[model samples]
Target: MPSTTRRTAVAALALAASSVPMLAGTASASSHPSTVVSAPLAKGLYQSAYSERHHVLWATTAVGRPPVTSSALLKVDPKTLKVQATSTPPVTDAATGAVEAVYGVAVDDEHDTVWTTNTRNNSVAVYSQRTGKHLATLPNVAHAREVVVDERHDLAWASGFGDGTVVAFDTRTFKEKKRVTVPGAAPAGLAVNERTGTAYATDLKGNRLIAVSPYAKDPSFIPAGNGPISVALSPDGRTAYTADQAAGGISVVDLRKKSVTRTIPTGAGTLSVATDRRTGRVLVANRTAANVTIVDPAKATVTETLPTGPNPNHVTVAGTTAYVVDKSGAGPEGRDQVHRIRLGR
Candidate 1:
C-alpha cells in the first residue's frame, strides 16, 4: 500500500453528507439470498480486478515504504480468479512507487484489450489480453483513480484525483481524445450508461457526483452525500449508487433527477458499490466490517448483510457471481485478498 495519510473520520462524515446523488426508489419488493466464497490473496493488494469479457484479472503488487518501487501487473484467469501471467512494464521513476497502484480495471471486449489506472503513478497501462503483452503507457494522469471502457462509444475514460478531470482515450490507439473537468477533486470511481453516453464520476474530496455529458460542456453536478468513493449504475441506467467510505452507507442517485434521493446505511467504510441488474439489488462492500450489505433501492432499505473477505474494496458481478477484492490492511503496507458471493441464491 502507498504511504499517504488516511482519510480522517470527519472527512469521512463529510463524504457521507455530500456524496449521495439524487437516487430514485425503484427497487421492487424482491428478496434474494447471498452465497459467499472466501479466498486468500497476495500481499500489497490495492484494488485491481478481473475483466470477465477479456478473460483476465489485472492486479497490482506494491513494494517498499512510501511505495517507491514500481507496481507489478499480474494477469489472472477470469473464470478461475487466479494469476494467468505477469509483467512489470517500465514506469516513470517519479511514479515508480505509485505506478501500477492499479485501482481500476476495464476491458474492451470487442477489441480484446484491458486498461488499468495507477493511482500513485499518475499513468494508465494498456495491455493486450490475447497476447499477454503491454501495449502502451499513457503518462501524466493526475490522480488517475479509476478507468471504465465504453465499448459502444469505443472510448476509455479515467477519473483524475489531482486535477478533478475525467480523461478519455481511444481504446485501440491509446490516444487522448477528450478531457472533461468536474466540480471537485479526487475522482475515485466511475460508471457509464452506454445507452445514454452519460459518464458518472464520484468525487472523493467534494462529496458530490458529477454527471459528464461525454458530448456536452460543463457536465451537470449531483450531490452524492459524504465520502462518495465508488459508483455503479443500475442495469436499466435509470439509477446510480455511490459507496460513501467515510459515511458508512451508499448514496442513491437518480439519473433522471440528477439528485441524491437518499443515503442508505450499509456498514463502516463502504468501500465499493455494485448493482445486480438482474436482481435489482445494490451490493455494498463494507471494508471495515468485512461484509457486504444488500440494498433494496425500491424500498430505500438494506435488505440483507453478509460476511465477506477482510477489507473488501471492490465489488464486481459476473453472470450470477459477485467478486469482492479485500485489502486486509487499510494503509500502504497492507496485504490483499479476494472473495466471492453468488447473488439471487
Candidate 2:
C-alpha cells in the first residue's frame, strides 16, 4: 500500500464520502440470487478487477476530460466495500505537466503488479501491487481503453481504441513485444487466455471480435453484434462472450467455429461482461439501464437483473462475488461508486 505521506498527498483526488447506504442487500425476484452493497469511491469510475491472490479489488477513475488532472488507482476490500489504498499517476505530460489519468485496470497477480490504461493520455502504466508505486508508463498507445495480463506468458495486452490496434508488452521487461492492427476497427475491451497466450479484443466500430494469437501470422476476426465494447472468455477458452453496447445484448462466439452462435439480449447499453469460473455464469453491466444482468450461458438466457446505481460501467468477478463500478451517485454532483455483489455459491 502507499505510504501515509503519499496517501495524504493524493487524498484530495478521492471522494470524501465513504460507503453509500446499502443499495440492495436482499436478493431480487429472479432465478439467480445475489445481494448488492455500494460505496462512493471517486469521480469517473470506469473499470475494476479483483485480485484473487491479494483478496482485494482494483479500480480506475479519471476525473473530467482533456488534460485530466485528477485520476486514481484504488485498492479496495471486497468484503467491506471500503477503499484500502489510493495511488495517483505521476505527471507524464512534460509539455502540459498533466498526470496520466487511469481508466482501465487489470491485476497481474503472477507478478504482484497492476496494469492500468491511461486512456486520455494514450498510454498504459504499471504499478506495484504491494507498495502502490508507479513502476513504468508505456506511452504512444493510441487511446488505450483496456488492458489484460497473460501472466502465464508474462505479457500485458492493451487495446488501442483509437488506432484499431492491440499491443502486447513484456510484463517482466516493460517493453513492447508485439503489435497487431486491424484497419478501420476501434478496439475497446480486451481479454487474454493465459493458457494459450491468445488475446481477444472487441471491435466497437466494426462489430467484430479480433483474435490475436501468439504464433499466428495474421489475426482472425469473428463476427459479433453491433458495437462490442467489452469481452470475456469461458474457463475452457472455447467460448468468447462480448458485451455489445450499441445492440444492447451479449454476443456468444464459438471460438472453434469463429462465429457468434447466439446474441442474447441482456439490457440497454450492455457495456461490460465477466464470467464466473465457479458457476460459469456470465455477468453483464448495463450502463444505460443501470443494472447488472446475470446470464446463464448454458441455457442462453438471462437469469436475473440486479439493479445497481446509475450508469453501471464495469463488473468483475472475484470468486462467487461480483464488483460493479458505476459513474453516477444519489447526490447532485454524481460521484462514482463501487458495488460489491455477493453471489452466493
Candidate 3:
C-alpha cells in the first residue's frame, strides 16, 4: 500500500489507463514465440502506450536529474521491438508554462497526436505523432496523472488527483472542455469506454470506483478494494479490474450493476494492469512482488505468475505478448527496463 504521502500517485483494462492504455495493438504472432526484452529506457520510466495507425509503442519517462530536457517519449516499433524515435513532450511551453513530469500517455490516431500528463505542471502536453512536434500545452489539468483521448466526443479526458475532478479538453481547440467532480476525495486512476465515453476513476480515499461521462452528467460508483490505485476494463467492456494496492488484490466491478462482483487475491503492491486481447486474460504488475500475475477475470482466479525484473510498475499487451515496464533503482535489476512476457511459452 502507498503511504499517505503517496496517495497522489497511480495507472490501469482500462481503455484509458493512468499507466494502462492499449499501448500495443494486436499483430501477427512471431515465429520465434519467445519473450523479447528491451534495454532500460532511463532512470525513471513511466507509461507504455501503443499507436495503432503507426504500429508503434510509446514509453514515457519522469526526469530525475538536471538537463531534464533529456527526458522523452520513446517510440518503439512493435514489429521490430526496437526504440525507433525519442520525442520530448515540452515541459514548459508558451501556452502552458512549466510542464513537468510526464506521468500518463495516450495516443490519438485520427488526429495524429500524442497526449501526456504533466503532474507537476497540472497540464496536458499535446504533440504531433508523425512529426514528433510539440503542438500545444493545456493548462489547469489539476495535478494530472493519466490521460485518454475521447475520439467520439473529440476531447481529451484526464484524471485530476489534486482537485478530485476529471478534466476534459477539446482536441481541436486545445481548450478546457469539461470538469466532472469525482465521487470520492482523491481520484487516482482512470479507465474510459472509447465507444460510449463512459469513464471509471479510482478514488483511493473513498475506496470506490466512480463512473461518469465526461460529456453527460450522470455519475455512479462501485465499491473498490482499499487503496485502489489503477483500473482496467475487460474486453467486453462490462467488467472493470481495479488494482487495489492496499487490499493486495483486484476488485472486480460489474459496470452494469455498479457494484463489485468479487475480490481476487494477488501479490502485494498491485500497481498497473492490462488485459490480453488474444486470450481474455488480465495481466497485473505487482511492484513489491517483482512479478506479473496473469488472472482470469471471468473466474476471478490466478492462472500463472511470471517473474519480472524489478518494480514492474506498468504493463500492456499485444496479442499473447505482454510488455512490462520497470522503474530505475527499485530492486536487484536496478535500472529501468522492459520485460516481454510471452504466454503459452
Ranking by lDDT: 2, 3, 1
Backbone Cα, N, C clashes tallied per candidate: 32, 1, 9
* Model 2 spans > 4 angstroms off: 1-32, 93-97, 331-333
User: In model 3, where do residues sit more than 4 Å from their true spots?
Assistant: 1-38, 65-70, 79-81, 91-99, 330-334
Q: Where does candidate 3 clash, by residue pair?
A: 11-19, 12-20, 13-232, 13-233, 14-232, 14-233, 23-49, 23-50, 91-99
Best by lDDT: 2
Best by TM-score: 2
Question: Residue 43: error of model 1 in Å?
Answer: 1.3
RMSD of each: 9.4, 6.4, 9.2
Residue 96 displacement in candidate 1 (angstroms): 8.0
Q: Identify the superior model by lDDT, candidate 1 or candidate 3.
A: 3
Q: How big is the positional error of residue 244 in model 2, measured in Å on the Cα after superposition?
A: 0.8
Model 3: per-residue Cα lDDT over 111-197, one tens digit each: 988999887777788888898888887887777888877777788888888888877788888888778785446777788888788
lDDT of each: 0.71, 0.84, 0.72
Q: Choose 2 or 3, whichever is better by TM-score.
A: 2
lDDT of 1 by residue, 1-345 (tens): 111233333342233222121111112234545545443445665565556666556666655554546456677554454566776655455643334445567777778887878766788888777775778878878868888889898889898888888888888788988887754477888998898887888988888887776688777778887998999998899888999998999988887887888888889988888888787889898989877888888898887666653577788776676777676642223445555566653
For model 1, the superposed segments whose C-alpha errors exceed 4 Å read: 1-32, 64-67, 78-80, 94-101, 329-335
* TM-scores, one per candidate: 0.83, 0.91, 0.82
